[model samples]
Target: MNRMTKTALVVATLFSASSFAGYEVQLDESSKLTFGGYFKVDLRNVNGDQAYRDYWIGTSTYAPDTNQTSLQAKESRFNVKFTHGAVTGFLEYDFYGGGGNALVSNSYTPRMRHAYIAYKNWKVGQTWSTFMPLASIADALDFGGAHVGQVFIRQTQIRYTNGGLELALENPANATDANQSIPDAVARYTYKGDFGQVAVAVLARTFDNNGVAGNADGTQFAYSLSGKVFTFGKDDFRFTYNAGAAGRYISPGHNPGDKVNTDGSGDLLTTQAYTVAYRHFWSEDWRSSIYYGHADVEDFNGLNADSDRNHYAINLIKQLNKQLSVGVELGNYDADISATNSANSDYIQLSAKYVL
Candidate 1:
């Protein structure tokens, strides 16, 4: 065949294969293995409270009086999967592990983010909490982008999924040095349609502190409804509404809804959160995401009173290629402690990420 014929055949083959799902496979059929994930370097500058910047973005309350700038590659992560017959195991890790500061010694370690084994529709081990819907997350630059109104947790769990129904029994989180008598239970239902995706989750947890003097066990319930809509050729609009003890279960650190009261009692604090975000594509290679999240905290026994907060994030991303992309994000967080005392934090992050 002529050189032109060869080029035409290659183009045709590429066009035909574009519909395949993106995944890489290695190893033989007897013991197949797959590896994937990304390498990311983020250059972040904080306008205030340099002392409190966290591996995860600091909430408004963590703000301090200092301005700081740092260069970090902690978001870099990878995952490995092994498949043998009907059983499969997977492990993933990232460099956000706690140790030294990103701006200081930079002696952080790589920590396990996910480790699980799956058989058919059942999975066991630590992974994303069942109380949150990953499908509703916005494609933003922040590690978790104002994860205020979202359930962002990972724990050891035994989960089963069938069609749209997913259920899990997760390790109890005894935050108050209490002996957990029971495990946390989570259930989620997700539906996918031509329009987009919708998901709802329910969580039940038991909290107890063995210590006497107001140390009591409490059972609380939390739930959430999240959905996503696609528009403008693959752009996504996402929203989530969460209420009840879901704060401790989903977004434990984002705000003050850690638990109810300060007495090591099991009483779950009441909180509500709402988030809305939209991602728009200006061109095939460029996109932007705008998001706003609000969380309300009701003071209980002076346990936590950073009060309610609103967070906003905006970003513009450019895809250099399938494996290389870069973006910049700006985030603002406002805390309403009272009418007279309010605090805010601002941040700008520039990142370049290569995924495989």
Candidate 2:
């Protein structure tokens, strides 16, 4: 019985007798091993006219919530998937409980949102990315109002797909030092047809300034392009777009000394981003979407040193049956700080979900 438990009981008795040996188990061709989950509880109200500090939750100043309500568990998830033969595997867990821009945390803190392994179209570990084709400004419950150019960063990659092309090899999260010289490489390409889907990405990094100190001499290069489109009730309706750019190289003791320019002594910065979205379903149990995003950061001395951000969102989903659902979201953010100050923030959410 040892030997790895007899090879997992002979692979679970050959996948449960080849999943019923015939054509009567058509719940998507049986051979499945699935267990789903979803639970959300949120009631939030935030506002701002001036006070809005949350800098990823370090919150030093800026507090304005004339009508605040708190309770969170926004991401209570559990998912397990296994499909025999052509191979597939997945694991997901999130218990939501943390601060600093919450992605998931349950104090015991075990965050591995998804563990992957796939075959037949190849894939390996960590997920999300075929370059990330914008799904109409996606909103799986306003994870910070979506659209951070839609590339949810869960790296550790190697992938290939056919039937509309896809290729990837990524691992870019900025090697935050250990003798910095960053370039964790990342590449992506994707294309899917029927008038939708398109993606392109590239990242070569080194800007883990987390250790501050003259911002660690900088160095970052990023590029991205994203897409999505759909017209009329085919999948209900959709339209989406994404754009990106990031460039930096500041060596020379982090430049910036009122030196309005420099290229050899090193100093150049650029950051531009964009996202647009629209979706509508209004049937089969209702749906809705609307999105917008923008970012700009430029500084190479030209004293106007820049920084600007904006986001907008709207979502409503309802499915009240066969696993339940209800959601509502609203969002806003604006920042233009270094040009005579500007700040704004807004949020509202209500959610309920249950899915087995």
Best-fitting candidate, measured by lDDT? Answer: 1
Residue pairs in collision within model 2: none
Provide the TM-score for each candidate, comma-separated.
Answer: 0.84, 0.30
RMSD of 1: 7.3
lDDT of 1 by residue, 163-257 (tens): 99999999875454454579889999999999999998899877565554444356778889999988878788999998886545545464433
Worst 10 residues of 1 by lDDT: 49-58
Question: What TM-score, to 2 decimals, does candidate 2 have?
Answer: 0.30
The residue-by-residue lDDT of candidate 2 on 1-356, one tens digit each, is 35575457546654775322221111244355665666666666667743532211101123444344555664667676777778878888775434434355424343667788898988888876444544544544565344433333455677777765556665543333342444345566657688876666665554444544444345545566666767778442333333222332111112112121234333225555566667777887878777776655565324566655666777888988867788887877665544565657776778877665
Off by over 4 Å in 2: 1-30, 39-46, 49-82, 89-117, 120-126, 129-157, 160-202, 205-296, 300-303, 308-334, 337-341, 346-356
Candidate 1 lDDT score relative to the true structure: 0.75
Give RMSD (Å) of candidate 2 vs. truth: 19.6
Q: Which candidate leads the pack in TM-score?
A: 1
